[model samples]
Target chain A: MMTGAAAIAAGGAGSARQPRNAALPAVIFAIFALMPAFAALTAQHYLVDTGTRIIVYAVAAVALDLLVGYGGLISFGQAAFIGLGAYAVGILSAAGIGDALVSLPVAIAVSMAFAWITGVVCIRTKGVYFIMITLAFGQMVYFLATSLAPYGGDNGLTIDARNTIAGWPVLKNDTAFYYFAFLCLLATYLLCRALIASRFGRVLRGTKENATRMAAIGFTVQRFQLIAYVIAGGIGGVSGFLLANSTEFVAPAYMAWQQSGELIVMVILGGVGTLDGAIVGSAVYLLAEEWLSGLTENWQVIFGPFLVLVVLFARGGLIGFCARLRLRHG
Target chain B: MTATLFFVQVLNGLQLGVLLFLIAAGLTLVFGVMDFINLAHGVQYMLGAYLAVAFYGVVGNFLFALIMALLASLAFGLLLEFLVFRHLYERDHLDQVIATFGIILFLNHAVRMVWGAAPLTLPMPDAFTGSVLLAPGQLYPVWRLVIIASGIAVAGGLYLLVTHTRIGMLVRAGATNARMVSALGVNIKRLFMIVFGFGTMLAGFAGVMIAPIISVEPGMGTNILILAFVVIVIGGIGSIRGAFVAALLIGLVDTLGRSFSIDVLRLVMAPSPARTVGPAIASILIYVLMAIVLFLRPAGLFPARGR
Candidate 1:
């Protein structure tokens, strides 16, 4: 798989060496795969639901990593893509089209279309300007959704049931949905990894490192970036579709900037540029969020300083931190 | 009647613009000088409103509470700079964004814990509480006019300071060519602190002034923070003049857009759809403007660091 080369692709841009070992990613995936059975054994039915939720968000986080980590494009609007995807499903289901056959493509297409249109304008700006513009566009999505009176407005829309898989009632079972989401996550992971290892991925990496130099060497940097942006949006759409199914509801809050920030936080927490780190990061973040909120209502007070400390100390996120730990013991 | 309403909306826009300048002034200065992105800057504005309310509860004098709150928020900003932000100045933008974002979460929640989630209020001072007649059947609140005057006064004062003073020269120099200024033996760290403190104080001042009109609550900074970001991006990073112009432009555009979007849309479409589309467009009017500005001028309208 040329693990070192792929890690270097992400590492060199972040200026932090991404560990090349496949162990961490495998372990995380193993845990994800075993989650439903573990939940059933423990009789904690909600654990399956939690596992499904994590898988859904992890999908979005991975796509976000494709942007922030691999491409060096810090889009603060990833959640807007997710919102577009979910709304596609929600709106379609309301129109009596509840089959995945119809909703899936609609969800993915709408998000990609949005990503393409916004990417054209967004890729023109750089640095903080890029962040602000993405955020502004995300806000545009949020306000638009809130004004959707027919679709429930500020309160959000509800789907009565899961979308049928080709007219088969396959996704109605919680266990089935869990595996369904797990498979989707796997597909997204493999797709992102494949993308990062391809020539297109290499050019994106080259552009990230030195766009001017790449441009000098005859690469249309913005066009490549726009494509990556659109692809990531498509993946975010997948996450949103899963999320809508799991919750059976979608709201304007799906597109909120805060949700976008959390996705970025999740990517950073796992270790930017590590595709599996995105999955690990969201799982860790959401689990911690659940546990902490249980103990204290003002959990953010503890969590906030914790994030500050992580930024100050954890240079390459949890993955980097663990690599250093292994080296120390070795 | 239509003319008076339009005039009133213009003043409302100017008022909103003035408040934005207060927040953006500090944001642009810190960003321009330190090259640090403080996502928590909005919380500083929220803290200002909260502190003002607390001080008013104790002191019972609007003027005294305002001064005390500004000083308190300034001190707090300095404390944050000393503790967390100073370390992040040398870090990458990603780390800076995360750390400050964490601070925003902390403060917004901490404020919730302390003040409760319910919105609080700061009453207008008795003297300025009255409304002044603008025209027949048109009366405007005097406090809003005070906000505009004070905002302009701050802008004028900042202009003089940047143009005339030695420290201001260092700030301008720092913004344009920071490394060069540092090589010439200026204590850049101290300069950063001074600018950061001043910016924080201005944000706090704006919050105090506006607290009377709006409900003071947790996470108030989040929404306004986005607006401040928009203002700075449009105005050009590191340019106070840019902030002033962009702030007013956004304020007027946003306010008037919200007020008249439906009427404008009605001209091109049926009233029913127009009613639905108007608010959505109005909400994004500034963003659309931001996109247009970025498309035409990627570096912003007034790039202070002239390439």
Candidate 2:
């Protein structure tokens, strides 16, 4: 799994040379896995809840990183998939269908369908055009969600209960739900890791570097990008499913362009091209948000400048910044 | 009644187009000249409205408040450019987007802190408070006409500035090839600041103009910002003419779509379903148009850059 060729293909070689880089992901996961115990010791249920939220966002951010960081597709509409996933569960639950098996697949299928259609139009344009088109599609989804009056519309819909695995409320327990979200995050991270190392991933990366060259090499770049977009949208649906179950609510706000922007910010904050960076970035961002909002109603004033500083100073985000430190010391 | 509604909506659409052009002109110029994406541009518009409110409190004259707000908005925009944006011109688009987004977040919250969350209003100038009859039983606001006129004036002024002036030639050249313009010994930095300041003032002017009609509030710029983005994208990123055409096109389409979508939908579907689906379709109409445009002309109707 740690072969030289695979590492290079994964864009991991530069970071792989740094010894601390090898252990960072394992350390991050260990921290997450033990977070339940830490929460129990402190008797802070809020920690577990917030932790669950962070992990769920990490899942979306990782999926986003696949398209944005790896494929150079700065999709400003990833939240639409997340919204679709939540709405799938919300709509199904409203109809008295609470089975995870049924709703989760429906969510993914719906999101993929959306991604397929929108990605086709979006991938036709590049640079700023790509960003705006994705945003438009996202807005379209948001407006559609708000118009869904029967399913609660702009006010949002609350689920009576979480999705049951084969009619068993296994996720009813907080720790169980936390581990479930953790597992989902781990699976998504590994899947992205594997995807980026495959031949398909190489072609995607090649296109990001130079689409014309990729086309010259006989890869229909748009087809590959569209496939990547659909894959990301499906994974985003997973996060949305988890989110709806975790919070037991879904609203048009979930799919707003702001949410999509936050997802992109998470990827950038973590380090755009690094898979582990996405997870770390999501954790840092959400935790800071929770902490800041607790401190002041005007938390964005602080958070906004923080983001500007990050962009100005922290070139590669937390992960990149850390790697740079290692290079300097070593 | 139908004809009256149609006439009123067209005027409303044109009014909306004029406002959008004011914002989009600056946005397109900044994008064209510097290749910088400023998500906070909408905040400048919001700031303009807010400034007009505060200045009105001090100056006690609408015209004076308007001038003061424009100057303040220009200064504030230039300050931001000098402090934050100037550093980001050479960075990735994502970085520019994120950094500017941060500015938006900061300012929106900061404005909320200063002014409170409640939406404030600017009084319509006394000179233009009255309505004029277009026909029998059809009247339109004079202030709106003033907006349309002022927008046309600004567009005309910008056309002269960009096409006939030396600075305008440099801006056009920079949009087409910044590196070449820089190599030719033009002070690209000064040019960026000038372009940025002018664009900011345009957005602010739009804000002040519309403030009397709409509520002045923090985050009011967000939706308009999205609409402005839609304008520039459809207009082609760097072309002022494209922005003007696309802005009006969008304005008419959106206004007409929202007003008539239900009527059109009723022709094809049952009334209840039509009522429910109408607003949703209307809201998405511009995006659908954008998709079609991108599908047909990937670059836009009037791309400034050479393909």
Candidate 3:
């Protein structure tokens, strides 16, 4: 599968020397499979919990990269769908359906519906106009959350308990939930890798390079892009579900434009379009944020300038920078 | 509400519009001339307020503090343009957007670190302390009236500079086509800096003036920045006249909607329901207006070019 995907990626490569890429799913699964024993050896509950959160975000970040990196759609409202997913679980639990099976589908359905509605208008514009429109839509949802009187409004809604699966009591334990999240992350990575390597993914990548050329080739560009948008939104919803469950709280702030911005930063910081890069990026970003905030409440004062430097000086993000160093040494 | 209250709100709206116009002027000019979509422009406004507070602390005189603050803001804008923004001109809009957004994050938080997240206030000068009767029974703040007057004065000055002066003609040319202006031997880099710096100062001045009334705090400019974008979009990007008209229009609609939306709704519905729904709908009015304007005129109301 790795060789096959690499061959497909090579078909588009103009350069003679194709970059040696490792298969990401196998790498991630092997590490996560070892996570439990490692946690046991280390006696660290914090590691397991933090690791679970990172995997959740990694899933969402990869989904976001598919749209932003490959489809040329820069959405600053990805969190809107993530929050939608989380709220799906919370709202359902409140109404007496606390099963993960029911809540997950509800989350996916809600996210798809949101993507369809927002993507319709958003897809019409390109460039800066596109950015602002998506942002406004995100704000509209944020306001909707704030206005929701029954589900806690600005204060936020708290879950009654962690979601259960078929009366197994699997997710009641932190270690079990950690593995559950890890499994979801692994599934998402494989699904995304397959999607990006599929024939449809080729068309999407071509459209990103030059939409006019792709359209001229008889592709229904908007439909393809919209489909991609829905997929990303659905995946983002999964992360939101994980987040809501992890914290057992859902708030409008979770879907704020700023959160969307941070998600974008995470995607770019990792290496936009690289599946493994998303995981690495989310880990780096979340950890940096956690450590920095602990160090100083004004962590953003330092983080902000760091981002500017990354944008101004660095190209292709942390992954790209590492790849460059490898070439220089190798 | 009394006639005077209505009149005062109208005056208040105009004053707000004036401040918006000041910020929008530079934004329009930068967009028109440089074709740069700057997310960091709001930080310039935030910096202006912060600078004014700092200057007031140092000078202890309102007028001198404002003058020095404006200059400081202008200098900072020029410095940023020189250092960071100039590199972005040849890049894609996505890269520019990302870079500027980074600046916004840095500056908003930087201000918080410096100002301690607590809202600061600028003292109103002794001369403009009292209210004057606007209509038979309505007393309005004299300081607000000064704001309206000064805003108009600055607008007039900007108009003259852009239209009648040599540099202004060059700026007009630059707005239409930066390449053509450069081809004509104008120092385009200098012009960009001057335009950006001036725009930055105007945003800052608007911030300084409003700092007396509104709380000077971090993230204050974020909401206003979005509102300014709406104004410029409606007014047509790159057109100062359009910004002025659109700013006033937004000011009136927003202020009036906030004031009478409930009453207007009450006329047709139950008072209790109207009271609850009116404010929510009122808050959404400008965004709805923006969506409508975008639908009708995608480029904007007064697009710089006919296209």
What ranking of all candidate models by lDDT puts the best one first?
Answer: 2, 1, 3
User: What would the per-residue lDDT of candidate 3 be over residues A8-112, giving only the tens digit for each residue?
Assistant: 342332111335358544665687778777988988768787788788888888898888777778887798888899889889988988888889888988998
TM-score of chain B of each: 0.99, 0.99, 0.97
Q: Between candidates 1 and 3, name the one with more favorable TM-score.
A: 1
What lDDT score belongs to each candidate, Candidate 1 first? 0.90, 0.90, 0.81
State the lDDT of candidate 2 residue by residue for A195-283, as single tens digits: 98899998988887668889998999999999999999999999999999999999999999999999998988888877888899899
Error of 1 at A119 (Å): 0.8
TM-score of chain A of each: 0.95, 0.93, 0.91
Of the pair 2 and 3, which is ahead by TM-score? 2
Badly placed stretches (over 4 Å) of model 3 are A1-20, A23-37, B1-4, B267-276
True contacts kept of each: 0.65, 0.69, 0.32
The positional error of residue A130 in candidate 3, measured at the CA in angstroms, is 0.7
For model 2, what is the alpha-carbon lDDT of residue A325? Answer: 78
Write one digit per residue (lDDT tens) for candidate 2, span B1-307.
3888899999999999999999999999898788888999999999999999999999789999999999999999999999999998877787888899899999999999999999999998899999999889788999999999999999999999999999999999988877789999999999999999999999999999999999999999999999999999899988999999999999999999999999999999999988888999999999988988988988888899752
Candidate 1 structure quality by residue, lDDT tens digits, B1-307: 2999999999999999999999999999898877788889899999999999999999899999999999999999999999988887766677788889889989999999999999999999999999999998789999999999999999999999999999999999988877678899999899999999999999899899999999999999999999999999999999999999999999999999999999999999999989988998899899989989998898789888642
lDDT of 2: 0.90
Instruction: List candidate 1 stretches off by more than 4 Å.
Output: A1-16
lDDT of 3 by residue, B230-283 (tens): 788788878888899999988888898889889899999998777666776777
